[model samples]
Target: ACTVARQKSDLFHKYALRNAANLLKPEAYLKPLEQKIKNVSSILKNKEETVLNAWHYRKKIIDEYLQYISFKRNTDKVFVWIDEHDECFVSKLEELDINDEGYMDFVRALK
Candidate 1:
């Protein structure tokens, strides 16, 4: 389960970093973020089953955490930067009204 857990963490970090970048000022550790992405890729490369599980777990965590995410008032548009590697993995982000604040605030893979 270590492999799965590790990949899960990496995925979480990536999602957190990406989401943060979208809503807040960029921080450091980008090199580590890149490394974690590679780590998850390596883990998934050798274990295909874990890859699918990682995707699902990522979706779950993102859905849960994003409800509390609030964009700064300066925001006008949301830009998604898709990695070429993740293009074919999941469907369009299933945008949802998770915040229940009269508008949608979260996006996840469709179940």
Candidate 2:
């Protein structure tokens, strides 16, 4: 989804650049702007991958935590609590420290 959004933004940016260039000079070349667009697109692509990876990692931790909690108490009640406060739960999960593991470090690295 992030990638798609970036692509849409890039499409708009490309046309905007072309229009401005045309207005300034009929023969104006857009090679420089094209290169910049490519650079920004590459950056967005890398960031999107990093974000998706972080979400996957967070999901792994949340699943493990849910399993642990479910075993200790009522599964339905635990699920309801998780569903009710999903944002809070995910935020806590993102900051959670797992033993000596640097899970929060990974979350912090997500751009």
Candidate 3:
């Protein structure tokens, strides 16, 4: 039972991170957000150690993540992804509606 609970929690975090990775500002939040998520795995290794549960932890992480993304915007920097072929892909962070079918298809192709 305990093992199953841990497995479920691990799966939840994995999916959460995967969803976050596809977000527009993911380049800014990925590293620190990953560190925050590692806390979940840490607790599974040592149950006696107290760690934030998934809900509270995820909310806190999201709040901080949004702040981090917003902070980057103030710097007036545009994130560009360069492929192995040396092709540059430029994106406008604020303009991304996250609902564009064409853009989603392009992103899938890039992966």
- Best-matching candidate per TM-score: 2
Cα RMSD to the true fold for all candidates? 29.3, 20.2, 27.7
- List, residue by residue over 62-92, the lDDT tens digit for candidate 2: 9999999878788778778867887775577
> Global lDDT for candidate 1?
0.58
Strongest candidate by lDDT: 2
Writing each residue's lDDT as its tens digit, candidate 3 over 1-111 gives 445667776787778778877899875766776666577656665662333455578899999999998988855443332443323332442246467778767765765
| TM-score attained by model 2 | 0.50
Task: Rank candidates by TM-score, best first.
Answer: 2, 3, 1
User: Candidate 2 overall Cα lDDT vs. reference?
Assistant: 0.74
> What is candidate 1's CA lDDT for residue 12?
83
Tell me which of candidates 1 and 2 scores higher on lDDT: 2
TM-scores of the models, in the given order? 0.25, 0.50, 0.32
Task: List candidate 3 segments past 4 Å from native.
Answer: 48-111
Higher-ranked by TM-score: 2 or 3? 2
What TM-score quantifies how close candidate 3 is to the native fold? 0.32
